[model samples]
Target: MFKFLHISLLLFGAVFATCARAESVLFLNPGSTQEAFWVSYSQFMQAAARDLGIDLRILYAQRQPEVTLAQARLALQGGDRPDYLVFVNEQYVAPQILRMASDSGVKLFIVNSALTPNQQALVADRADRVGSLVPNDEEGGYLMMKELIRLHPPVAPGKSIDLLAFSGLKITPAAQLREKGMQRALAEHPQVRLRQLVYGGWTQQRAYEQAKQLLVRYPDVSLVWAANDEMAFGAMRAVSEVGKEPGKDVLFSAVNTSPEALQAMVDGRLSALLGGHFTLGGWALVELHDHARGVDLNQYGGRDRQIPLLQLIDREYARRMLAMGATPDYGVHFRKLSAKGRPVSYRYPFNLQTLMR
Candidate 1:
């Protein structure tokens, strides 16, 4: 099993003697549609977690936070042996969830975004679990847009921005923080006209429907700022169905270097894509494994449990990502997949300045 090397744990290769089946890790994904964005993320994490010898059992929600909370509460209270409680989508439920885990002796690990000040204080104060593993969303969003501005100069007077937006959940900190960074990026381009910032709600079908409505409402508007690749894919479908070129005719930028989005950026279908710390899920699982194995960091006088890593992608650098395959952290190699999955690189990257008229 490929286990992360513990800097302090004197043990080198096999942590457990060859016999004990690896410790089980439980995952609660927001939902389970094959095409769901989190589903892809969960699969990637599955591969990485397995590589690390985690016997992972996954549970799904009905895309409802309440459903997710119910599932989580049951898992924590379940008869099955429990070690760690991990989640990604529902930030609002975090504090209460962490509180519930306290009595059960379950450790919690969060991913994809940071907990708010209250949640952080509570989690740390209560020894709820460990810190968190999240993307440097502000930096990722900033870098992606920085590349966008560098490559694409607006045609209009002020290099302003417009939006064709979609987000998975308003509660998830990622969408908000990325938007914060993107807004800061636009501060640099004054004349950028931000027309429609419709919320797609993150579902592909809903995203497509929302975008189609926007397309009808503003026939001439082009630039699109999506929250995640799934929405972009939905928007992309809408554009294609309407005989509109996704990237060339209309600008598309989103967070998360999802497979299709990475391919789109490479193929010049998406203007830019900012990477997120999706791989940290498995990395976190390793940490969770360490904790479960009794490698107590707090006992070792180590304070911080949260570890954050970020990756950003855009047209200027999208080619390299496309060529190299976008997902190294998540253990994803796009080229390893079929031609449909093989990443495509764009020879001529999108120029934001040129695209905005």
Candidate 2:
């Protein structure tokens, strides 16, 4: 946001800017309990806020829009009448949330989900919304599929290839978008057969259960495309339990570059990963910070509806990075502080950083 780097002048500016009295931010996620992604999100925002000298509050929900809406209303009535309200998604309960934010005069930022065009109309164009943030979930799917194709090409003519696909939450847009990305790859490579697609709900236990069931149902499945890294890790465990080498026997691809997931890829226990939520979460927090500072999301080259960076790190590359002991950062491959909201590749001046193990 480039606002108030000098602490001496910060108090004076703060008092006059209406933001002087310590700005508050309310972060609402669907899951009430802390999970992997939200943990990273909380850590990222906490650090970013410290750096920017702002206060950001955290809240949890049970994957219900109602819970988020309730929290939004409570925030306004409480002492934390935050300057901004951020939600994991705004689709299912956008109307309710928009009304609450409007009543409270809070800035809105959608991280994982957004309002539909119809819902947007209900917002009366005063939704307090800045913009939305999401991991390149679908783009990650595309990159994973591309890697799978590279590893395994159709050999025999009309070869009936079998694959088991694991989906994220059945109803989330991420689940659908990831499914479509994999489907796009399958269409081009006729040998990559989709035999089963089970909803894993983004949990290792559920994914493991589903993997066990799919193994029994389709024993000859060639590859697996998990909607998320955790699900892929679960399937990897199942494959190992069944006396099979995961990467060597049946290639696996997944999105969301969790550190453990990337380590598995390095160990050759899992194959490749596409995109990641860790850095994206931090980046989104920064964007929201700017928005709360009166910066319009449409300004400063907005990344509206445009594809974010989609990283397709393979086992070899992951291994190299891990070997070097390099921890990736939010701006790992991103060039410049900001860019126009457009899909750009990291194949240029800023190559993937290799750690020196």
Candidate 3:
């Protein structure tokens, strides 16, 4: 009757509306919003998603691996399953999340975190993992060492130049790779002596405490190396309190140039930095969009998703890159996608050497 037709029409309209709703993406960010690096990355990803006409939902893990795993699981188990997921691999949970995504059929992409060989093997045959976008961390680490040695060359033959390092969390692969590069660089420089390597847990406060202890223990420390800018600043603070001038009496260098770090570099408080990894998140969104649209860039070629490091030696380059941040104009690389959202090749448009210029 007329009543039945009215109910049928209403149901059909509801189903149609649900079907027409825009696809959404869920991002699991590793750090708290309080940190500049994580905040910048999250903002960039959101901006890119908006520009690409995709809805984005972000969850912060506050640097806790357990929290990251739980948040991802909760999001996936909820009634509203996102069409795509973007996450960085947290310690001990990368495989679990990957398996979950694969089984749930959610398209997944990793950004900012490198996969281990075992993880790579596990994901090699999986269809859900579109690919990863990680920085060439080894080169980044090598560049950091190169810059440090270039600015502050070896001391006289009788005198030894002692260097201390504040490393990131032990569980992360990026940290491991960067450490590897540092080792490689250190091997070539016999004039420099690595006094100690301390775990800073990738935070300013932790680095501050550790640097304080180390400075008292090794008063003759000639240089400090840190895995990230936050830790570098902390180490710098410690060095300054003890009447040592960074970049003068003592030299310091770190990875990832925050605005503050760059300013310090300009002022001669910090020597150099290796960055350009922060853009990976925004670029990953573009790749995810393409993947959802049936255009797999990885299918076409080799190592297209791996990003490289950009070494910022002076103030000018740092200022420009910070200003560029995660805005739409910064993602010129993604503009090459066709109307169907496929690129001609898998090569990314950015690199360390090119960006440094």
Candidate 4:
């Protein structure tokens, strides 16, 4: 009986030790919970956290820079400091939070958006800044434009294809990178001409208003490219109001996988859609989980990892995705994707295909 009791006690001790080693992560979401993109991003991360046995907490910043900084300050200075803090450089507010996190001894990871070159210089020597995992926004932009141009080739051999673009806030790195991508695609295709590029502030109403006037100003423009789905929808609305068909008369392209955008594509309204970046948060968690287990992330990728997270969603792809349901079933084994589960030479291929498989 005494021997049996000893074995049971040892098993209990092992279970307790395993529970004690579980890591906690705090994510300061830069967007409000109401925002579909951010909500989906958090949901995928939660799924990953559950699979990896991580304790995850999220705080919404309502897309305000001041609120983001305030939340970071409270989380960093208060008791129950998390083992890691994940955040984005929205509106360039991450520098302040990075300093607070460094002082508080919390490791930091940036997602969605990365630090500016200047900010990178400031934190280049900080060991606590684990790394950044961002989508290839430039590639996303390039693909959007390239697809839009393909869908609507020049009307004639000599006639140039007139284009108009709607970009998000100019300050954000994602927007700037996307714009660069659009420019790169434009450079490659000499037959396409950019009539005007305007900032939509990432809002449907703003893009709608801009589109109304731009369509009149540049009546010959047939290709419209937006940095996000919301702006693309807005542009589509304006095109309809101006008595022009969106998908046929004027082709439109956007980035994001919102249900509305996918449905629009299925219905033959949206021309081109690039999406799947919403999985970044979940992929980031996989990296953090691996790191917590003493695996070096640098071996898989450098300190700043920019992977191709976006894919051009075609009409059939959109239909299939909608059939799956509103929320995507990541169906991914977080453990297998980690460093411990993968081979020594395995490179992380975190993309839509991974989730789908």
Model 1 over residues 1-357: C-alpha lDDT tens digits? 234446324353345543255666777776555643566567666765656666777777756778778888888888874567778646577776776676786767776654687666655665656656666776666666666665554565644445555666667777677677777877887655566666666667888888778887777656677777778888888888778887777777776655677778778887877664555555556556556555554443232433334445655555554554434443342222212222233111111221111
lDDT of 4 by residue, 1-357 (tens): 999999999999999998899899999898877767888789889989989999999999887889989888888999988989999999898889877876797899999898888987876568888888999899999999999988885567887988999999988889999999999999999999999999998888999999999989998878999999889989989989988998899999988877888898998888999999888988899889888888888787775888988889998888876765454446778878877756568788788888766
**Which candidate number has the best lDDT?**
4
Cα lDDT computed for each candidate against the true fold: 0.63, 0.67, 0.76, 0.87
Residue pair clashes in candidate 3: none
Look at candidate 4 and give me any clashing residue pairs.
none
Residue-level lDDT of model 3, residues 146-233, one tens digit each, is 7888888657777877899988988888888788888899999878889899889889999999999999989998778889999998
> Cα deviation in Å at residue 315, candidate 4?
1.9
Which residue runs of candidate 1 sit more than 4 Å off their true CA positions?
Answer: 1-21, 89-91, 121-124, 156-162, 241-243, 294-310, 314-357
Candidate scoring better on lDDT of 1 and 2: 2
Q: How accurate locally is residue 203 in candidate 1, as Cα lDDT from 0 to 100?
A: 68
Report the backbone clash tally of model 1.
19
Q: After superposition, how far is residue 296 of candidate 1 from its true place, in Å?
A: 4.8
* Model 3 TM-score, 2 decimals: 0.87
Candidate 3 C-alpha error for residue 291, in Å: 1.3
Give the C-alpha lDDT of model 3: 0.76
Q: lDDT of model 4 at residue 346?
A: 78
Candidate 4 overall lDDT versus native: 0.87
> What TM-score does candidate 4 get on C-alpha atoms?
0.94
| Model 2 pairs whose backbones collide | 14-20, 303-341, 324-355, 324-356, 324-357
